[model samples]
Target: MANAQLFKSMQQSQPLPAALARNAEGTPAYALTPRHQLAQYAATGCLNATFYASAEAQLATVLELCKAVEPSFIAQTAVYCRERGYMKDMPALLVAVLAGQGAAEFAPAFQRVINNGKMLRNFVQIMRSGAVGRKSLGSRPKKLVQAWLNSASEQALLAAAVGNSPSLADVVKMVHPKPKDAWRAAFFAWLIGREYIAADLPPVLAAFETYKLDPAQTIPDVPFQMLTALPLGAQDWAQIARQGGWQMVRMNLNTFARHGVYAIEGMPELIAARLRDPASIAQARVFPYQLMSAYMAAGENVPTVIRDALEQALETSLLNVPRIAGKVVVCPDVSGSMSSPVSGFRGSATSNVRCIDVAALVAAAMLRKNPDAMVLPFEHSVVTCRLDAHDSVMENAARLAAIGGGGTSCSAPLLRMNSKQELADLVIYVSDNESWIDAKRSGATATLGQWNVFKQRNPQARLVCIDISPHATTQAMEREDILNIGGFSDDVFKIIAAFAAGQLDPEHWVGEIAAIDIAAGC
Candidate 1:
């Protein structure tokens, strides 16, 4: 019983390698190790996968002894016991599929580990030359292996992976070794045929080539509105609604009196009599986030480069005026992998709220451009506060709520940002880019350039990526250097941080696709 199926595949772990815990601890690890016969073949014990007479001769005897094993039981099994073939290891499955587990649930044990393929093509060129996720990357592949290398099936490869439109060569053979599947005919001749960040992605996701002999009981659950639908044009759909945004200045007041009353008074024929019967549009978009937070007023020329990115984020706030320094961590993301539901309000009781929190309550008014700033709350990670750093991160995120939700973690609050870097050492992460930072970092180096960890342990730090979904107008026409912060109005987020600081070249304007009604609203 080959050591009781190697101890029933190391106590039912399924994904096992590092030479079955360094050759069952006799100190024989993975990757071409001197490993003395992998500690007498993982201490024999009588191999287990429940006495494999079948699971296809126990995964073809773990991929024919992981293709003539040696580099110590081929990296010593783990990705669910080397994708069920008992752990054909390659330096412990290349440090567990470059730590992001590339395509887990035993990604077809990436087919006997690509039999000598540049460790799955240099782990997709070190996560597509982005150099692994940046708030200092080290957070394991928590973001579903960076959403399987930014998906792509078609919609013109999710509109050229978000530079908006262009992906064909028959949708680049469904996301092959990718660079939008090798510039699909120079991005479908640069989309002269509209391409909104298309996405269908499923071509052997993270390469596996197939052969371990039947074990894939089926998987591939990818639906976040099909990779956040990316197509736009006609002057970038009127600058995503001339940046005044939110469905291009969405104002519906059949009765806006607010904090005083009238709250959608009868609510658009009570939402056309509850959408002609039942009851829920989240109770009819809860009177449009309460009349868009009571007709949100305040905007006078917020330009001087967004008053210098709110005075360089209020001179890295050690706090001043209205009592200085510390506390503003509003981390609310009710997980269970965020089960989407929210549509339009007050009903049978439900709210998966993520319409991009109307751009996180309009970027938490950038903590009134900084003063005591705090909003503490989180999911999948950070959620514990005894309430002190002098209170008020919006009065302790109004005792922030969380019934529970899962899957979302970015290095679980590295000891609360290294024990509060003197009043928030600049962290302005706002998601909906569908989080991703597939791990790896040690003596860092790799740049699109944005460095600043000064006392944070630099990896070219300066960081800031605020993509409020609708794929930030296809990642601002496809990354000339990534800044994408389009409008939800505080005068369209101070002209989207001065059109993301090229000082604003909104190309004299004319774009809005509020779900197309006949066409172009002047």
Candidate 2:
């Protein structure tokens, strides 16, 4: 048959059809291996595209575009682009095609490769929830529709986001900007107010009166007001600062105790032993940590051994406020003890700095009920970026990867934004208890934007402090003013519940574990 001969002839010209081929399954003669082929195709574009020229290709492979060409191609393409910031239409069009965005208007060079390049799917993933600047990247037509609609899962949203369809209205509603129900009501209320204004002017806008307006504020910023309620605690993390040629370390054992491990117990000893002398453990060279963290929320029934073992986990586990809204507002202690090796990726001389991941969870908890709620991060000045889950397939991925450690100067940025009154409903600041006042030079860093104006009324702006410094104890926490969130999810949620209920006070938070069964994922 002609088909059989074509398949045979294709193999003769191409190599033995390695697993890394872009259209392996479409080739019909050999099996397709995803990982191996992705790694290979990434290095060279020689993988033929003829086999995947149309939906007919999936008839043979059947794998969704997400599973097949999503990361495998995105990684290579992004890496390539990073190497060259911007190029001719070819590179950008290549990414547009592989990302699942439309590519019809692209140059012939890109069209030539669209068959197997697999860029369409990747582009779709990045711009699922109405990304800020997706329209400029060529024609992002929604090519696939009916195959996956009802299931507005992360992957589903990404696919639907870039595709073109009248059915997309429902899909867009499913992936709108409201952060939670509270946020929707808040936004809806604003819509009604707008409607009232319009009805007073235009005749066509009269029908808008029927829609009920809900008034509520959805997004909350840094929990600045909650800082007073932070549980009074012993210090946990240590800080190191370099002046000229000397490095000094500041350690807090009380915070470690608050973390639940007494200094005399084997836990503290174990941690001390590891840090003081690492050659011993490295000599064994195990695959993973030999011990499960005792820092788990074991409550009163928790075994003494585990309670003892938990002492060492306190360094990173203390003051951990698990689960926030969409994103937790984090300001790294990029000063004395928190400096990174200045020469590596992003800004690093080394990668030994500590990152505060709990703030995002607290922000997420705040925004969990809103579709548009988000947290803003800042240093000397506040960074204006807000994170949203609908913006990506798994909002959690972005949450987990929000790692930044640098010297922090709070005044410059906070003052800048305060002048503009762009502050959110709530604001929370996480730090190691070291203090800085008005450290801004000429450049503005963090802008509070009206926080000072609203401070009298919303003093407890959901602010929580993670006292990583033992010496920082008396400084940052001024009574039960800031909600104290230790670096433990089990207790962190408890503290949040208490704060929400107006009960996260120093008198009630005894550092005791909860008796109820803890969730599996937590």
Candidate 3:
């Protein structure tokens, strides 16, 4: 004898949409458009083997995506990824594709995307590898490379020399850039192994040469790789640690400790102060997850004072994490695949931070900002993880990441909320978006169905799916209420805030990429 209106409200009112494709785990999922796929790859892809895709597979997919989209879209995506996503390899690869296609948008996009020496090397290497059609840097690309070499400052050029296999010297040999000044002329000659006046060499390069010739001389203020090959004492390592930038110090804390940088008198306190400096952290654009990595990787020999500073740095970096209004629920996917490195596996170059670590960090960060928020860690089902609202983000994240390694069920958390009749204004999911265990055979995905059921109780609720891997599928379709974003960068927080506030258009993430001003010089 229930009221007809009430009974109807309890049932799903809208027809569920069918899943467009299968995920890496053979789960029914909604596929992203070609542009969306490219953006997703550009943001999170590291061109390495992932849990579901091999390096060759990812590369082939990216190349195919470049051809599927418009040349202008490629340019915009490159700019957006480089400027806002803070990505490296993917952006360079995109530019290489544009160059090979002979697209007119290539020049300006190249100017924006190739902003550093490492990027220049990547572009050069990708072009010459014939991966993007043309095997060599053609006239336009060669001119652009020459211009970059000619306009670079002495310090930038020296820093560029730090990496190799197609080192700055190799690049000089390939492009043969004409020097604009005596210092550049000497530097170019020195790099390419030609006769040049040592006195005319830039001050930093001259100092580097002097130190290279005599280990007793003072360590030159060059890239750390430029000095690591030489035998250095404790005092020498300490000096390098003191002079290194915030990012360098953050990444090499263990190296510093191994070489006795931390054992020196008062060096620990000095390094600790630098680590916690707000201005330095901002200037370095330090990602919050990077701090987590540093904290977890610090060796026993590392000073406790420095370790504590890393925690502080993480807190500072998370200042942008939005404080959502009303009831909030954070669902972190702790599936077995998430145990893989967040940046994908690259042999020795693989990142130590797992995808689960980042998922937990995002959940913990949200809880830290919204104290009353509920955290649900899920794999095949909801995992029991009791977190303290008063606990540190690091502690809570550690607790959440330590649980759940079963198959992924993206609907588990939503279904749990539905069973509890929980009303939430916001639900944030940090996952890889491969929901095989709960995937539906027909109609909408199990995730979408569960979301609809949950929405029946709380129609005002908004869902943000933050994909931490480079995949082109999701558990739920993007609508006015659902948002899909990629990458583990802090920028994801800002995008989430804007979407939750109803500031984005229907196109959402793709619109954001399209809005990038690639027409400035085109």
Candidate 4:
């Protein structure tokens, strides 16, 4: 009776039962939801003392706190923070988390430090890895050195240079006392032991001109050592398209779109050709849905021609798709809170894209993968869709988005499924997983309760939760039959395939996905 009432109270968003209320730290026990705790970390530069059961347990909690955001969001926020100059520590924290998790790559952290002047210590530590900082030095090894001289006062530059690589004394001897000559002298000093000579000075000088206009906004694609510099006009973009192909275009699509240069005439055909090309097609086959999701989320007003070409490319690719012998139910949460912008994209302008938009797209993609699957969107209520295999992902997304937003009730789908006697073999919910059920009201079973009720009828049913935001811990994931995965990448579905096959469990699920890039030579 006590347990029943505790579950009932959860429906109204009241506190959990005292026994389950607090974690070892005496903090509210919500899975992964650290909104308030994160704020405390930001202010104190340390996690609260009560987050862990004991001093021994505090270490793991600190690591968990570091990895509070999805991986893709970590990359996005790193770029976003540098561009807009917001939460600089977010990048550092992400790097620290990934490092703690045994990830060796720190290229993103290195670039974040060099370009934005944040996370310098982290960058320095990561640079000790041979592969970390080399890519961001920007063709000319002297670009950062020049920027430092131009942007910093003489004393500031000298102070920064005091920690000797070859030694600050050598750099000071090579540099001029005047700030005007400081950049040229610093550039000369950087080149002293390096390849090339004074003959290469012209291109470096030209690159430095653009660098001075905006030291922080340098494009990663352009090399500092190139003999001539060209504005990122149609000609340069065309050359890039010809040489690097669709993959390159995919990487730079957001950047070009932000710069208003993605829609250059004749470019769509080039992109289409690249998508259709056999080599490019093979690469797509390796990561079909992932490539598609990245391309789709790249910009607004994506040309239909490109979308159609991608559809063809996806159909032709031999990407992994595990066939299940049972019916599948995809539940996408379209609750009111899901309408909020994900990551740092908060404000009215970027509000057009929301967590629900991502969830709906993922559901649509899953529907495409499973021809016999059905989608039932749940908010305060459940709505069924009469979807056809012919509908494009965006069309399905539009239909789901049109369902609009209301209060959250994650259990509604399970309850409705029970009522309809149409339990599924597999049920996947793409949601924020913040369910509020009121036991005081009629028809109120918490999600777990509904799942248990549904299982009595369909013992084989399994639950896979795709968390759009990793801000909170999930209740569904506590069970062996339930799997929780996060991130916006379509490659996550491949992980789902592995999980469904019984080849992976929650413990090794993430480890497997993280190994794919290096494993596949991607």
Question: Candidates ranked by lDDT, best first?
Answer: 3, 4, 2, 1
lDDT of each: 0.30, 0.31, 0.90, 0.52
Ranking by TM-score: 3, 4, 2, 1
Q: Which digits, one per residue and each the tens of the lDDT, describe model 2 over residues 1-522?
A: 369778755654442212211111121111123432232122211212221122233212222322555433433333332221111222333344444433322233233222211233333333442332363333223322211222223323322233233223333333333323332333233333422234232221222223113112211111111111333222211110111001001122233444454433354444444432334323322111111112223345333443443333332222232343332333333333222121112332222222333333334434433445444454444545456644421233235325454444444333444566544433445443333343223221112222333344444454444432211021222234434333322343446546544564453232222111112111
Q: Give per-residue lDDT, candidate 2, residue 436.
A: 39
Please estimate how well model 3 matches the true structure, expressed as its whole-model Cα lDDT: 0.90
What is the lDDT, from 0 to 100, of the residue 484 in candidate 3?
Answer: 91
What is the RMSD, in Å, between candidate 3 and the native fold over all Cα?
2.5
Per residue, candidate 4 scores C-alpha lDDT tens digits across 269-297 of: 76766676667766433344344455557
Range of the 10 consecutive residues with the lowest summed lDDT in candidate 2: 240-249
Q: Which model scores highest in TM-score?
A: 3
Whichever of 3 and 4 has more lDDT, that candidate is 3
Give the range where candidate 4 is weakest over 10 consecutive residues by summed lDDT.
43-52
Candidate 3, superposed: residue stretches over 4 Å from native: 1-12, 213-217, 519-522
| Model 3 C-alpha lDDT per residue in residues 263-340, reported as the tens digit of each score | 789999999999999999998888788899999989999989999999998999999999987898999999998998
Better of 2 and 4 by TM-score: 4
Tell me how far the alpha carbon of residue 58 in candidate 4 is from the true structure, in angstroms, after superposition.
Answer: 17
